[model samples]
Target: MYKYDNFDQTIVNERVEQFRGQTQRFLSGELSEEEYRPLRLMNGLYIQRHAPMLRVAIPYGLLSSKQMRMLAQIAREYDKNYAHFSTRQNLQYNWPDLERVPDILADLASVEMHAVQTSGNCIRNTTSDQFAGIAPDEIEDPRPYCEIIRQWSTFHPEFSYLPRKFKIAVSGATHDRAAVRVHDIGLYLVKNGQGETGFEVIVGGGLGRTPYIGPTIRSFLEKKDLLSYLEAILRVYNRYGRRDNIYKARIKILVNELGKEEFTKQVEEEWQHIKNSVLILDQKEIDRVKAYFTEPDYDQNAGDDTGFESALNENSAFTSWASRNLADHKVAGYKAVVVSLKAPGIAPGDATDAQMDFIADIADEYSHGEIVVTHDQNLVLPHVKQADLFTLWNKLSEQGLATPNIGLLTDMICCPGLDFCSLANAGSIPIAKQINEKFDDLDYLHDIGDIKIKMSGCMNACGHHHVGHIGILGVNKKGEEYYQLTLGGSAENDAALGDRLGPAFAKAEVANVIESLIQVYINNRDEDERFLDTYRRIGMEPFKEKVYENN
Candidate 1:
């Protein structure tokens, strides 16, 4: 984790006080609502359907145990008993008092966390793979570059207010766990034939009312030119991106209208002027950022723990959880344990204050006091010793954090729909619960295997519904809530938007619809085929026929 220096601390502390004044003025009626709107948004405060929502940034999804404890404290003292973790790997406080937002910001600054850029039509949080440094398939750690972007973008006057919100994602692994293809700017860290490292840049990828898988603009870009190249892209978007309609304001729309070739040409032209400027990162600076993410100390004799093997043999429950929740680590005798937030009956991506505290303790005890939040709404203890697996599993199980449903049907990504978001067409949490109840059997879910169910309450696509294996979008038709389904979408290496399954179904029909689709996959799948594989092999006709047969 990157520790804040005096400059970082000073900036955050100053911003807290500045926002404190702005909030006070708004409350005192000295600043009109129009005047306070941008100010509050800049500080990551939103007036939601019920109460004010505060989104706190967890940069590139990294969190120290101390920061986690602070988040738990904020949840306990300020909001309700729980907070919601968003798809961007940020945390949202749904019930924070408007007057106390400054206090919350101040508290967050103390822990080197704040809510800046979590919302608004500015550059939002830069995200990366949850398994960044620890993944076995990674070419390099992407966090240093993510941190570089964060430093470059925060309060950059040129990009302070773009035509629309901007998102950038980087992936260092062979697997695209960061969903880079669906971001405004996606960077895949790669090595060329000569073995020199650089980025494969993709632009125009986004999901909303209109969805697109970003096209690669630069096949290879030197590592030193990263920031300069990003600035060029932003400059192009800021100058030409549509400002007349909010719906057409994202950079994706600009790229679509101008064509990928023209967009790339413009960016390249702009980059020629600045590529060798001060924006180019030097080796010293790169090494400094990389130093913050160095690997933790490991025991030399850590392999082949007999106790862990015995526990796996003795306990079927632990075995199942391990199969689903544990990921392979690059270091031998270590594993990345995913702490699932989508346990039965819990709202997806939400954690109670107690659960947060318990997780912080677990991180300290098992993962070297570090926690990583995944964009799929799960937490990762990225450096857990294999020897301590059984005991860690038991602790997580006791706290309701060990669901063993990672990447399963029930471990869905969902947004705060009508329950919290005013823009929502329907309630997503209830639908999630309905799905959970319908698919309560672990054996049945395991059989279905590795299906992603992402639901959004509206077309804003905050839940990333467009990229799920089974994407569910809530729609309002003639004042009645209905759910639409899409199949075969994936957010991994083969990134693609899902195909719609004909017509929308009533809200009550969603769970049954999902069940029918799953049954179709079960009936049609070949040996060892996943839901996505089966869907792609047989196409949508079979699943659509099954889902709409009784309608």
Candidate 2:
């Protein structure tokens, strides 16, 4: 994890003082609710249905043990004793008093964290692949670039107040774990023909009321011109993106209104002027940022211990966890382990103070003192040695953090729906719990195979329902809560927006509807095909026909 320098420290300190004063003014009634809204929002505070929610930015989803401890402390001291981790890998506290926001920001700054750009219509947190360093297929570490963008976008004068919020995701691997396709600006780090590293840039991709899989504006952007080219794209959108209506204000709307060819031409014209400027990265800056993310020291001689294998054989629970939670690392003696937050009936990403303390202990004792917050709403100890896997698994299992259902149907991605969110139409967490409890068998999940079941309480798409293999969007029909289903959506290398499957189902029927859809897939799929591949082979027609056949 990158340590904050004097400049970083200074900026955050000043912002905390400023927000403290702002909170004072708001509570004293000098600033009206309307006036205090944007100020608090800029600092990542939202007035929710019941209470104020404060979102703290976890830059690129990287956290040190110290930072994790700070989060646990905040949960205990400021608001509730639990915090909800968001889909963007940020953490949210739901019960903070409006007057105490500055105190909260001060506490966060103590740990070198803040709530900046977490809300309001500005460039939000820059996301990257959660498995960036350890993933076997990565082209390069994407966090350095994400950090660079964070520095550039933070309080950017011109682009600070855009028509709508802007999102950017960078993926170092060919596999798109970061859901880059659904971002306003998606950058894929690619190697050119000569083996030189560059980027494949996409623009106008977003998920909301109008979901769009961004178009490729630049197939190969040189490493030096990364920032310059991005500036050009943002400049184009800032100048022409719709502002009259909130719904039509995203860059995706602009890209749709103007065809890809014209949009590309406009960006190209803008880039020609700025490509060679100071924004172009040189080796020194790249090295400076890369140094922060250099691989941690490991003991190479720490060979795999048969103890872990024995534990797996002896304990069916451990065996199940190893199957789902553990991932192969590029290094011989190390494995990447995902600490699931989506337990059977808990909030999807809510981690309690004790849970945070337990995981922090595991990170330090077992896998060095580093932790990763995966975009899939899970925590990761990215460099655990194979010899210590069993010990770590035993500890995690003790804490109820050892659900081994990664990428399976039960390992769902869900937003903090109506349970906490004011924007939600129905409850997403309970629905996720219902589905998780319905499909608790790991072998059954593995047999069903590689399905992303994303649910959102509303169309805000916080859970990214638009890109789930089986997407569920909650809707309200005459005050009755219902869910709309979409199929064939994906967030990988071949990203595509899901198509809706007929009418919405009442809250009671959601799990059964999903079960019926999966049954249809099992009956129709060819030999050993994944859910995505099967869906692509035999479009939504078959699943749709079977799901709504009774109607």
Candidate 3:
């Protein structure tokens, strides 16, 4: 976790003062609701269906136990007793008072967190694998770079107002848990053929009315030129990205209109003008940023714990949860634990105040007082000792945070649909619940392994449905809720957009349609093949044929 320097602290403090003034003006009627709306949105305050929603950024998904406790306190004192964690690795308070939002921002600044860039058409939160530092296959920790980008993009004068929102994701691991391919800009930290570390840059990727798989704009960019390269990409996008139509403003639409070659050429030409300048990497600045993320003092020989294996064999629930929720840690005898937010009937990503407190306590006790928010709407304790696995599981289960379904059908990624979002035409949380109930069986869900099921209320694709192994997009047709399905999509290393599975299904029929598609995959898959692999191998024809034929 990056500690705030004087400059960082000053900016946050100043922004709070700025927003406080904005709040005053809005409340005093200097700005109309229409006028105040965009200004407030830029500050991460949304006037939701019922009340104002305040989104607080958890940069690169990192949170200290102290910070987590502060969030818990905020939820308890200010708004509802719960907060919804978003796919962008942020937290949203769904019922904050409009007048008190400035105070909230002030409080967040105390803990080095704020709401800026969580909303509006600016560079949004940069995301990465929750297990970045501890992931076994990581090339390097991505957080330092993520933090650098976070600092650079925060209120960058030229990019604060873009044609549409911009999102960026980075991945240090071979596995793309960050969903990099579907973001506006995806940076894969890589080692080139010459053994120099750099980024494999992909551009023009997003999901909305139009879904696009980002094209590789740069095969490799030296690590030193990161900021300059990113500036080049954004410069090109801001200059040429469509603004005439709201429906087609995303970089994805621009990329589609101009093919990848032209897009790449434009970015390259832009980079040529900016590269090797003062904006290029400064070793001193890189060190200053990277210093905050130096590895914690971890025990060297924390070898395999036989006690954990014994516990696994004895408790079936614990074993199941461990299997799905635990990830391989780079350090021997340590594990990365996923605290699933999609437990049974609870709204996906809604963590009550008590749960946050519980997580804070657990991180303090089990991990090194650190926690991470995953883009999958889950929380991660990246360095839990293997010896303490059973204890942590029991504690989490007691707190309703231990759901043994990760990457399974029940672990759904959903947006705040019609229930809270003014933009949503249909409810996504209920749809997730409906599907969750339909596939509640632990064994069954585990058998239909590693499926990323995402849902969005509308085509804005906040839930990232376009990249789900089984994507569900909500639509309203003649006042009835309907869902369009897409299959074969993926967010991993070989990211690809899902093909449409066919016609939309009525809300009631969604579960059945999904089950039928899963059954088709089961029938066609080879030994131990995941849903995505099977979908890619056989294509959409088999699943599409089965799903629509029965209808």
Which candidate has the top score in TM-score? 1
Worst 10 residues of 3 by lDDT: 296-305
Error of 1 at 302 (Å): 1.2
Ranking according to TM-score, highest score first: 1, 3, 2
Q: Sum up the clashes in candidate 1.
A: 0
For each candidate, the alpha-carbon lDDT, in order, equals 0.93, 0.88, 0.90
**Cα lDDT of model 3 by residue, 277-303, tens digit:** 877988787888888887777777666
For candidate 2, write residues 333-418 as lDDT tens digits.
78889999988888788899889988888888877788888887899888898878887887888899988778789888999888
Indicate which candidate wins on lDDT: 1
- Of the two candidates 1 and 2, the one with more favorable TM-score, higher being better, is 1
Model 1 spans > 4 angstroms off: none
Residue-level lDDT tens digits of model 1 in 1-551:
79889988998899898899888888999999999988788778899999999999999999999999999999999999899988999999999999889999999999999998888878989999999999999999999999989989888899988998999999999999999999999999999989999999999999999999999999899989999999999999999999999999999999999999999999999999999899988989899989998989986667866787889999999999999999999988999999999998999999999999999999999999999999999999999999999999999999999998999999999999999998999889999999999999998888888899999999999998999999999999999999999998988889999999989989888999899898888888898799999989999888877877777
RMSD, each candidate, Å? 0.8, 1.5, 1.4
Model 3 whole-model lDDT (C-alpha atoms): 0.90
Candidate 2, run of 10 with poorest lDDT: 300-309
Q: Evaluate model 2: give its TM-score.
A: 0.97
Better of 1 and 3 by lDDT: 1
